[model samples]
Target: MNLSPKLLEVFTTALAVPADQITADLDYQGIPEWDSMSHMILIAELESSYAITIETDDLLEMTSVTNVVDRLKKYGIEA
Candidate 1:
């Protein structure tokens, strides 16, 4: 699935990866750039970009791009 430009920017900026690499299967720690350190950055970026406070439980569920998208759904977000 293609990501919205805003969502694409979040992944790219937080992970320091190319936009093309931000696929649904992009798993946490599955890539060198998306390691533990970057995961926290990614979470912070998500919160900032969406203006939503993610819960601790939801954080563990954010294992992949698809998972992040799903998690956002809980907040009534379209990304």
Candidate 2:
């Protein structure tokens, strides 16, 4: 499971955005598509995809693609 592609897929599908538009620099709430509802959906997608539970602090810290990768790393996932 390559993390990059999986991340893109999750964000794209969850946010209803184009795959090419998602980047490491893309931040949560940085775009209209990444609203509160989409954030929860995105979290769900990520949790299901990685098969891990994210703590509240970590969930709040997941602001960008880079942040997500870093957080997942702590859970034994590498991008």
Candidate 3:
């Protein structure tokens, strides 16, 4: 899956996990840095990287690694 490199960096850093560990099935709860603050940072990071605003519905639905790609795709981002 070809994803945005900046998005990958944001997720990996925000989750405190290696980039390779990030995948479609990986849930946010599985990472330590996926807490409240991190979630906020992740949201901001995604916005900055994609140059697009994420909707509240998409924000609430972002539970797993795949969900990020999914939500962004809905906004016209290629997966």
Clashes of 2: 0
Q: Give me the candidate number with maximum TM-score.
A: 1
RMSD of each: 0.7, 2.3, 1.6
lDDT of 3 at 24: 76
Candidate 2 local lDDT, residue 48:
97
Q: How much lDDT does each candidate structure score?
A: 0.92, 0.86, 0.80
Q: lDDT for model 1, on a 0 to 1 scale?
A: 0.92
Give residue 22's error in model 3 in angstroms: 1.0
lDDT of 3 at 68: 83
* TM-score of every candidate relative to the true structure: 0.96, 0.90, 0.83
- Over the stretch 1-79, how does candidate 1's per-residue lDDT look in tens digits? 6788999999999999999889889898899999889999999999998889999999999999999999989998897
Sort every candidate by TM-score, greatest first.
1, 2, 3
What tens-digit string does per-residue lDDT give for candidate 2 at 1-79? 2347777788788999998778778888899998999999999998999899999999999988789889988899887
> By lDDT, who's the top model here?
1
